[model samples]
Target: MTDHESAGTPPGTEPAPAADGSPAGPAGRFLARIALGARHLAAGLRHILTTGHQSDEEIRRTLVLRQLEAHDAVRDTAREELDAVRRRITRLELAGAEEGWTPEQRQQVRMLREERRRREAAARDMGRVPFVPVQPTADQIRRARHKGSTVRLLGLLAFLAALSWLLVQRPALLAPAALAALIWLWWSGGHPPVLAQRPVPDRLLARPELDPDAAPAALTAAPGQDDDQDQDTDLRHVTTADEATARIAAALAKRKVHVRSVAPAVRTAYGWQADLTLREGTVADVVAVLRRLDTDFRVGTGRTLAEGSTDDSAIVTLRVLTSDPFANPPAPPVRPPLSCSILDPVSDIVSLDGEPTPLYLAGTSVLAVAVMGGGKSSLVRDLADYVTACRDAVAVDIDPTGRGLGPLRRAALRTAYTPEAAEAELRRLLAEARRRTADLGETEDVWQVTPTTPAIVAFLDEYAQLTPEGKGLAIEVLRIARKARISLVVCTQDATADVMGDAVADVFPIRVLMPCRKADIGVTLWPSAVSEGWTAHHLTPGDDHAPHDAGRCFIWAPGHKRPILRYVPHIAPHDALQRAQERLDAGLPTLTATDGPQAAQAAAQPIVAVMLDAFAAAGAEELTVAELLDALAAVDPGHWTQWDTRPDRLAMGGREIKRALKDAGLPPVPTVRSKLPGRPSAYRLQDLKSALDETG
Candidate 1:
């Protein structure tokens, strides 16, 4: 059995044990160490409630009160232990006959209610919130709380013993053990994280396992070195750790390699991972001054992810030196260019930022979950610059608030807004995702993207706007998050904890939090982020995730432990819109865009998407032409005067529709020859058809 499984390590997390197969791998061991504290507390609590061994009643009661205040295991927390004790008391009273309520029951409930009032009053006086954390952390976390364990154990045993002494004890008194076990399981079960499955050994995926004598591709005691290797060859047939390490030592030995000792490297499904620590040496020396003994070791470089504070750093990388390695994945597309109208700014990334912030995770996708204006809009704008145009790429925006493609109009295969629009676009993207997963799972040997084509990105902006529209986007985001091909950049201003309910929100395993105004904290943080009166200015955005300026962004790639601020190369949003128009004008085939005949309609009355509201107020009747003209004259006299009087639909032509459809990404529809089948041409704007529908 793996170290994690045998140690009762939580599933999906790395094993926890020392090197040589001890009971802790980093993944399992860290959690175990963390979990160990809880076990001790629980044991202590059980002893207190059941043992009845209190030397001093006042001291014991005070201990219970403080324990309740510090204890975090229960569903609800309290400054007074009475809150939890009352709950237990209430449970006991309810389950047992009302006659069971002793003087203790009434006292516990009274104290509990008193504490509740204190907390409630405290909450009422709080101020506005400042930001949102997609990643939820324990608000009341402490060094290590062992309060409940002892209090509960002693308390429970005392209750049982008291009942037995009273001559009314029942066999059910033993039920405490069962309850403690369940609670322990719950507390412990939550300790570990789920990690990606370990990749098959190179020998397993390639050559068949041979006998002890035969050894072409089996998990050999040591994999052999290769002289003429293909650039795209799998690591299984390439090299080994011993071979790579010697090169590393030779490269930096002269400077006094303060190597902390390299542990046995384990291969993952996507790549290999091992820890590296430097005592006296710096990262620059490892990269620049280190001379190459064998070209293989020097060929690979280190990649790190730094976040929260600039002072902290972790070494992460994908190396080409080892042969029995994880399968290499296609590099994710860089951020695509923004609108041609917007000037793209250079990023201080390579210099100011010490580590590379990869947009995509191999065998894992990225998740961006934040309340809006926290720089999500600009971040999407920046991502437009990360991806290349050739991966048959496209982006669809489900929001109808005019951010159809955000600033991604230039490189997105196509872009769209509105659920009706997003639905059509998602169907196509989802289809492709399903196709790749089933067809290329083995042949392409990739768990995610293809190298030659741009992967489709369906970014939903202002997702909360459609909550009233019932598009089920909340759930859809989660489904797409775990799948292949498509990556989601989801943005919303809604701070509701259970947006669209659980089904949809639960799927989004990854989340991103953004800067918020303290006043809006109550609405945004839900039960999360308890601060109030916080402002967007407090959030830092950068490649390593600091506070945001104009071009900065933050990322939380999978496998990363925290959010990172990043320097996103600035791309103009308007220019992105222009390029999207250009691509549409070029008749580029795309799934969706501001390009189809829909573009004309999309562009004609910017207010049309707002429907009659833009036409008038929130609610209005179907008005006559005169009323519309009057309204237009009040807001836009110039257009009102220019509008033709012909009620038979103004004579419109391709120029209007072509301009609109250019960004819709679909080709302009053929011109309409007749007003209706077998009917003569009606007096209408010939240009309107192009303006209205692509092929109408």
Candidate 2:
């Protein structure tokens, strides 16, 4: 056969020779078929790797078992393309060797190795750095643990030693010296509890610490650097009070506040006190600088009071808290279990000096003044919950608009939404207050909770929204604050003279000044606050800054020098609802129009007429009040039960029966004697008939 014809028979297999001349062998044919099968297997593997049909997991499994083995590299393009598959398989095998033979184990080992390497590198870097000790704080330096006084005592002992030596030289002087020493000791012991004499104030000192030239780089660093550790480290060399003052001065200057000089830092009852003499600036400029210290500097600032200077420049006194007062604000006070007294633990005061001040909601009324969404309503709701929880407290809410107190209106015994309704409720409450006062009489000035004397708390929200008549009623209610045991909590958005009249404002000795629209309004609530530079205008509205100052406000009670920072804790709405539901389920009825005095008057008239007719039919003009009550009970047991019985009563007493009689419109038991001389006072049947006839 020709060479071309022979080449046409494919590579591994050949067509069998038909006739004579062509050679054919069984062993050759078998070897050719084997070669063909091997070639097909290689093609399948190439296709798999090129197409990426098999997953990585499958590829790994096949490579590990040697089911699909890698081939040698080649220079030709076609062979080189196949060689990439081998290389990929080899790389995967190497990776498997480095990792544990299992995928999950491999991942864990890789993470641990990475972590170990990172830790070792960190350690190497840390070893190369120098050690720097933290500097002692200013408070640490000033707190002597009575060491200075102890040193003074030692000096006194030394003087006494010298005196003893002199007496030893003259034996006769011992008796007189001993007596003098005893008298001195007695005098020292009898000294009043007054503070030790302090040295001249830092403001009065002309020390080099007060020299602005000493710190030419005053306020060189930006306010943001105050929080940097590097900044604190740079201050380690600040060994004297002068250096601290210079650092503060530098911080103020960086915020564009020109400072003439700074006084040496001095310890005071409030905190560190320093006077900063401004370079011809107003109080507004000083306030602007203080704002930067708190905002950009990230430092807790206290009151910054501006005083007039003789040189025409203002002297601003700075107070920096040693620690952040707001760092760990106390949680809102929890409601105590139901008790007879009207006292409650509501909020905690985070005083300017980082001290915790507890607020006890007792007999005093509270006035919360702020703009809308300033957390005033939250405070009111919390107190309302406490009032509703107390068994003796009568929670009455008055909101003419009904928006503020709507959610918790169910908790109130009497909720008045309209102006007319609110006025009526206020009048009734005033009457109740007068009645309570009369019950206390001169024998007891303070109200004590009995079944008869319940605490009446009128929680008035948005007092500025009250109508003319409602405002008048509110003024009347406030007048009975201490005298009639009536407490008023008046909340207003604008606590101006027009909104909250002086008489209404004076009723609430305890005031919470929330963030208002103007500082003057805060001053209206706390008159003395202007002098101390205390204002709530900086507090952010709503719960946006809740973690910092949501319920936070400046609180002024009767005995505080200035309004203090207090957090009026929030009560969960669900909790309030649950408490209210509990109260309602216990048979505490709502005080609606039907439950008012007019309703009682209408209801009692018919009953009175029936009883009077019954007495007249019995032909008795005069009968004892007890006998009349017995005749009524026999006629209508249900009406008698309504008037005479109280559910869930704490004790067995005649108070319920007496209350029933008064509620039925029966007059108080007469003191006039009966004709029988020894009998009880009598009710005239003829008068009852005449009263029934007049109604007809």
Candidate 3:
């Protein structure tokens, strides 16, 4: 009792005796250990069947394998996307080359292609370096250390259990067990646990850098280095003269135009020039097939030219410009000649073939037709510069808008800024021409222009703005002025019948057609000129609102039997002004007897004076605009009659009168209710007198 109490055992509870009624001994303990082992094994089996539990090593290995599989799938998807993009770029390039693309579209495609290339380079980099090393996180390291310790403890326990069982059962087997245990210990000590080793972020195997020899040719070459080589290759493949002729024949044959014989093509700075004798079609048929020829030759639009020969309509001259002929225009003359003769050519223009073509402005009328911003003003300024340089020429500018000839005003003999004043100036010139013709007296068919008797070159800008009567006067001057050494240079936006009457338009032998409407080309030149590759209508404007072919034109002159593309050298405004000032300083010649200050003064009389004279002729204190216009016409038949009786629908005689009065600094005409039937807006004589007095 005393011992049990000291050991802290309950007095009633004690160990049961073994089956032999004896105290539990070593054999009984061993049997109990076996039973405990059996129970533990059964519990493990239950856990396996119910939850499918896995060891940490198996879980980690499975995670690593899944991660590797996912990485491969992502790489494959990226490759597929890159391939799709490459295919799309290829399609766009092929489509663009087959058809045509605008500059903006081409630029967009180029940018897309560049982006695709950059992405492909990134994909290639990823492909080269298949994997990346990843540092383990703190939690991962802790788990790995715990797993390593557990595995070492399990190995030690298994070795001890095997050694004990072998020594008890068979002593001879103990040697083998000890040897196996030593090997296991050595392997466990040398190698790290599976979870403890550093993880590979990507694949285990990585490829090396691509070999230069195995790389694509485009990738191997340096940027822009291949362009020269490609250009050389293209030069080697340039179309020969015979090849060009054959291509031309093939191109024309598709359009049902037969070529009988072709001359050997002559290589020019641009591309080629050849003469062809047609068997079944005229030159128009050849021109009609230019688009097809451009495709066959791998050139751009408006690059081929075809026109009939002067002597033989059956023979056609074909020209093809491989590159843009007008990409770089020739520089204008920095300094024009200070003194020249009217008999000689005024200026030299460059043709498409890079040859200098002379423009003769002495005895013929020139009509320059262009749309707005088509470089018509530049043409006028060029002419003004030429005339200003002439020693035996006096330029008379009639610009209704007043801005066309503003820069060369100092060089002009007399400038008219209004339709009325222009009409008056033209009338005075007509009188002078008649006097000169009478003085000739059949001695000479043409007047001899000299420094003393200078030729008169009338520059009329915006001819469409002129009244019908003014236009009629201009035509009359054009008809009789050439014999008297007088020439007209008319510039207008269009040459439609309504804009420039066919009667006057036909008389202009030298026609310059700039970029304009398709119909304008036909109206400005002969009907056949449009069919002869006179492609002024195809010219378009650039982003700056100026024509792409600004100074380029198709000129139809008497010397040029067929239309030819020519570029008029632009004359800067400052240069024109400087030249004109120099000519003025040198004392330019004046017109004959009829072009002195008196005639100019009469022609340029103030509007207020004219209005006052009209008021006086009406013999009334106040008169309506219509009445004033009628009176003004009666007072000055040459200047004011055109306003009242202009045949066009733009006949605004009353409005013109009102503007004239207002322009003279007179108050607005008030509507007066008189005893007459219609109470119309009228101007008073008192107001005109006051304005005239104030101006004086």
Candidate 4:
């Protein structure tokens, strides 16, 4: 066989046999095969290691504590293992010699040991060892210490660098930094430590057997421990505050604590605290003492065992402060519910404050204001009660059909049905009003007109019913609304529109609306002020806002109706009634519901019978002035005398009388008609004697 180096064939091809022409034998071929197998095994191991395909056991072996030693440490460990193996081999040889071993056995043992040693040495060189940090030489350490000193000096210079720049800018910043440095030096450097450093022990710190009362030892080897054979821990040393401070100083000294100064013990609201300053000794030394102290004896705030605390030697707080004595609890918050209500009516019984402003209806600024409901009749009934409360306050009602004003007719200052009768009655009322106005002009103050002579409130219902001379009585209402002593509240469903009439525009300063479906009416009455963004949509009618009822009305007086002012509460119902009734029951001419005289039985029978029959036949929940107008607006708008100024109501008695006369076979009861002014055309049935002979 020829060596590959001397062979001159191509580079990668195998060499031919030598001139001896001997083929490569089995032993060499077997060795070549073994070498190839080893190369393949090495390639497989490389793939596993690089790609992390190695088994868990392989990784564990690679990263174990033995493999994780520092680089030099691992080398030293390898060398030591080699030495041990060498020693073992030597021992094995001695044992073999003592046993008289054969040469073949000895050779085999030596070969096996040599192979194992080579494998271990190879593993050591192949990057199996962890890296160890290089240790600096003594001179290098000295150079590092000098560099550290330079860094510290540079730090001090850096602080001055800011001041120097500031000095360059203004030349004023140096004085303060210099002064501060001087103060720091004086405070830290000049102060003598109260206790000096002494030797301490770890065992003594862990479970300290301290003798604060013991006498000073001649020389304390382990100064923090009381180790003399006869000496014991002095438990009495820290009994008083002063003694406690001294003991603390001694404990600190044993740990070589260097503080600037020690402050006297101070008392707090809860307990006592001691302020301490450490100077010469480092933070590491003081940390040992801090950990050794009682668990309950916590460090104060800002107190860290950091070396050189002159930079920020703030005191640490151990406990929290108590809460303030004056702090108030939070109040619960909730939203107000939405609501509205009609607060103004004669019998509404509610005042401006939503309290009762009862039986008396007087001094209402809303002259000719209208209400439309069955409930308003209750309010009108109370008007009689109000008139009784104020003697001079007269109520004039014209219930033509005996529906509304008829019940309280007797209490009216003047009651009339037909337009002619109403005109006559109103002439009387106006004469009284003109007289009262003249008297009021003479009075010093308007309110001083006396309780018996309070302002009068004339309430009128179904305002469109009265039409005299085709001009309509709404015009007459305007005159009374302006000139009469009493105020007017004229009620009708559709009166909110042109029906309200411009004639009374100057008189009615206050308008109280009950609910209505008409959005325009609410906006007209409210005019969107004092409602805080009052939308027409928010004005729902009725007493749904009964809770927030009082402020619902839009008050519109000259000086009193400013937008900024909140609505005042209304007077309640029952209280207003009592005040009115008291005046009337005192015989002060206060009008009352009961003050009216009951009509004769026959007359009442006709009214009650007609009312019940109309209600039953019509089946109306409630009759309204607007619905009645619509009912009559279709009818002869002119001949609606039952709704207007027609005196045919004598027809009831007249019809009965004429029928009786005819049934008895007598001449028809003579019909004599009055050509009364401002009245409907109608004939009246009179007695035969009177009709036949005026001479008699």
Candidate 5:
């Protein structure tokens, strides 16, 4: 036998004597044991209350079941033992009453009778184990609170009614009586009532072992349930942590990397996250294995996900895509007009795993590169729509082929269809940037664009076709990206470094790589892009030989971990035109001839000469200032800002021409009286001709 059985002591019951053979202080030893036991008891209670599934509720059910079983076991045992003692007592009584009994027989019968009586008294003296439940149900708690509140309210009402009667019957005695009662009540409740204390149990009370036959009815379920559970089908294949770990191990083993162990998997909002330690592999090796896993597992790339450590461990967060996102796309986001800055997400919302794709266009320049029919122009068109609708931003599109900015023409301040026109527009924008710098004070780095100081966004499609002049203009424009507040969105079919040289390419921090014919284009645009999983070469184009139609591409924007897939929205032509017209009708500022050099030339011409030419062209003898300004604006909108149509203000667009009559050697603008009241400014064509002939 072990030492414990020989000592007649149960395990963990008491500490043994010291080597010196002196008994340890029993009080100190008992107290120490009690403290340790109390700590463990408290910890167990806390775990029961918080750790298990449906912890509080499950704990309640488990405790109730255990209590019922214990009560039944103890009661049944006591009843059976008592019954046996009673039978023995009856036999002793019958023997004592018999005739011709010997003295020894009588003595033996008395001893048996004494023993039976002692056993009966002991059984009666054993106290009962009362059952007290904990954690009342929600309904029980609610009902208790309601009942207590109702009782208090009824008592208060009764006291109030009694006080009213007393006040009417004996007003003099009521105040004193009420004061004395309040004082008594306050004094009684001020000190907490003392509770009688009982000695804590020296040893923890454990429930008696329950008999299987006395188990609670609820514990004895229908026999077929177990068989049903065993036969139930689990379609997920991977249900437990062990199963998921096994799948990951198998995937890694295929790449010749053995997984030593998998950490406890966590269920994230997207999918499961697990840390994997390899027996012999580097982080790069792990990443390569994950890339292979993508073919079968569909996990994100290393740069975007799959973080690794130097200790040959990696954390791969993966989610299996059950269906294609494109096939069942979400409703496209509403297109809001651009405000002070140009940041807006112009695409249907899409997320990686659970992280939504971020597309912010403000405070940055962009470059879009793709082969022909690769949705490059479609992206530009979407951008142009945003730039046009902005109150303080001007949309200037330079599509040398004339087809790119069709829907944007009505909204744009200027649209160029020739290399010379685009070049001239770029030069004018560069000049505006300088002017803005002077206006804002050279010390200020960023242009605080406002109604008066508007931002200029120049969208140049087919950038590869730019002449030397346009290229020079592009370089200058790109140089003032952040400081001057000039944002250029340059797109091209050719993604070669030669087409967008180092100087230009370096400024475009937000590079969009749409589908391209060659994989090398991604490397050309960004050298490290290939390693970052910029796989534009693998993108499948849409049917009818169109590349994604709109928005689909890989975007490498600022602050992203790596390149992410996105689709640019395709705004219908009618919708774009309607929005632009709404802006015009709202009297918001539109693009003017001053936005580009070609339009600025018209402004440089003598205002009076332009006025005379307008009347000559119209073949009119007389015209109003409004008519002349309208004619000039229609002919060259780049040079002329739209006239303010506010009823409270005088016309400002034609004010300059009205003042320029004297400079052209003509009479001052004369006022023509209106039928209602005020005289409006008007000019005569014949007088302007006579004055021009005299000046000549």
Candidate 6:
């Protein structure tokens, strides 16, 4: 006190009482500094606690939104420039007549107009930029909040506990510690000069930072190098399903096609596929834009394909082929074991994605339609090879071409090379089906094929070449042969209704459409086959005497609701011949007499027999055609009762009867008067007896 009085000459000054009535000494200043440090510490801790709680997904979403906002800013700038150019052009136009502008002024206006057009194009391009939303799920937010709350509570408690300990044991050092911590936090808040001066990690940059010494060479690099790098970046950016969808959307938009949404692309061995919902367009629109998409995606021509969805007209499936899927076709399926069951799938058909799909031949009729050199014969040979390798199956070849079966003819149980033989085989198959139906138990629907009673697989090649009666017999067999473990594989080059009737084409449960006319697909397969992604018509056929996409086909089966592109395995003629010989050496199974001679006799009996019996029952000398038909219906209701009434078959009443009678070599009986409104044609009982006697 004495020293202070001597130095300042102010008695009882007490540091002159600071602004807040505190002593203006070192202690007050120290207290102020400590308070400032505490405030800084609090703010830093608060910042960490608040920011640390954000989930990675939330941060990513924020970043994406920011990027989109940046893009919007760029587009707005382009629009502003466009508007400015338009205004300048307008000003020049207004000044030209009044001020009589020179050549330079007119050229300036023209250049401004060009600039406006370019800016407009740029703005449009920006608008077409694809955007896919990525938002955090409710569950993610819940879990993140829970974890952040737990961590923040624990941190707060830890800080409080440490402060309490410091106050109890080392209160003297608390202020200094707080001060040091505040200084450190402030120092770390900014980018340190030492670290900021150094180059960032290469992985952190979009493209690696060029070496200082090589920068000159990089600048001098060819322009193609930059183009290549840009292309690579474009390709790499589409590594994910979301990215692919976005890219495809952008590409389609450039062609004036808008889509509501595109499902995530599914990766396949061939390439990738995605289903899209169009905003307001047909599938044909999408198909039209595929060529441009190929160019945009850098895929080669014919790599992109679009098909309408069968369920909805607005839905389309887009397939992008990245590579040649059939560049390396799979080897032929291995031969079956010593005695494979016919119930199992016979061979493997490789799908477009290079996956092996089993081909089921039993319990299903197959219709294969293809153009010339479309590999129909090769498919037939492969099927025959499989059948010959099975112990519970026998092959029947009905080819009017005689050579359609190739060397596999050796494996057939019965080979028919003429229309008459084909009809005979069809009748025998029908009889076998009838016999099997009668033999089944009440609870059993399908006959269980065995070695002793094997199933029959009839291969009817050149079906269009068959006679009308033969075609009719084949259709009859198809209608009833399923339960008897008998199926047909009918191959045809023409699939028109006149060539292959609707009734015959519709009966097949399995359809194999090879390279043919586009119209043939709808006729040979289902009406919705083309819409369901059956693009067999797009497949290339042989040209200049060379096979192209010969084995490619779209397989539509009962189990497959949508058509799948498949490649039928090719079996060489020598391989097929060897397999046939092996099967013949093992001794094929044969049907018993009940299924052979007796069943054929029953099937071969003419419709005249029923008519004759009806005449006998009527006990009349003469009856009109209508009266005879009615009598026949009562005698044999199974065959004659609903003959002309079937919706699937052509309706012919009297003409059908006359045709049958004429086929039996019977003379036509004249019309008779039976007191009816119209004098109808009649068949006399004596004439029926005479016809039956002559045919016998």
What is candidate 1's local distance difference test score?
0.39
Residues 553-617 of candidate 2 have per-residue lDDT tens digits of 77767555344555665666776677677766664422221223433343455455334433433
TM-score for candidate 3, residues paired by index: 0.52
List candidate 1 stretches off by more than 4 Å: 1-354, 361-373, 388-392, 438-454, 467-470, 480-483, 498-506, 517-537, 540-554, 563-569, 574-696
Candidate 2, poorest ten consecutive residues by summed lDDT: 66-75
lDDT of each: 0.39, 0.53, 0.64, 0.38, 0.54, 0.66
| Per-residue lDDT over 1-696 for candidate 4, one digit per residue giving the tens place of the 0 to 100 score | 222222212345432444565426765544444443333344343343232243332222223323224444756676667656545554554454334457875675567466645855575465343232233445554454455456655775797797678878976766886677555434432232222123343433321112222122112224334432223212222345564455445444444444455555444332334556644323334433443332213332111112223354432212111111112212111111111011123333332222432222344444222233213443444444444333355556654444644444544554556544444333333433443444444543333333344445555565555443212333333344343335555555553323443223334555443323333343234322212211212222334333221133223343333211112223234544454344434443332211112111212333222222222223343333232232322222343334334344344434543454445344443443334443422322124323323321
Candidate 6: tens digits of C-alpha lDDT, residues 109-164: 66775676578678768756644333445665566556666788798999989888
**Residue 546 displacement (Å), model 2:** 7.4
Model 1 lDDT tens row, 1-696: 543443444466543457786765565654664465354445444444433233232233333334433332331333245335434534543432222335775576456545645664544333122111121123322111234445565677898788666544456655775567556655654543222233434432332221223232121232222221212223334356564344333332333334445444544432333444543323433433212312433233212111112242223221222321212222222333332211122222321223554334222233344444355655566554443233344454455465655555544555555544454344444444543454453555543333333345566676655533224433432354344446666666553422322123333434444553332333332322222111222343334343234333333334433433343344456665665565555443243222234433544453222222222221232333343333333333444445456543233322333343455443543334343445432212333333355444
Quick one: how many clashes does candidate 3 have? 0
Per-model TM-score, in order, reads: 0.35, 0.46, 0.52, 0.28, 0.46, 0.51
Score residue 272 of candidate 3 by CA lDDT. Answer: 78
- Which structure among the candidates has the greatest TM-score? 3
Which has the greatest lDDT?
Answer: 6
lDDT of 6: 0.66
Which has the better lDDT: candidate 2, or candidate 3? 3
Worst 10 residues of 6 by lDDT: 208-217
Superposed model 3: Cα runs more than 4 Å off: 1-239, 327-330, 334-338, 541-547, 592-696
The segments of candidate 2 whose C-alpha lies over 4 angstroms from its true place after superposition are 1-245, 251-289, 292-329, 333-337, 343-356, 359-363, 404-407, 519-523, 526-528, 543-548, 586-696
> What ranges in model 5 sit over 4 Å off?
1-245, 257-322, 326-330, 335-349, 353-363, 517-525, 545-550, 591-696
Candidate 1's TM-score: 0.35
User: Which of the two candidates, 1 or 6, achieves a greater lDDT against the reference?
Assistant: 6
RMSD of each: 24.5, 38.6, 28.6, 40.8, 33.8, 21.7
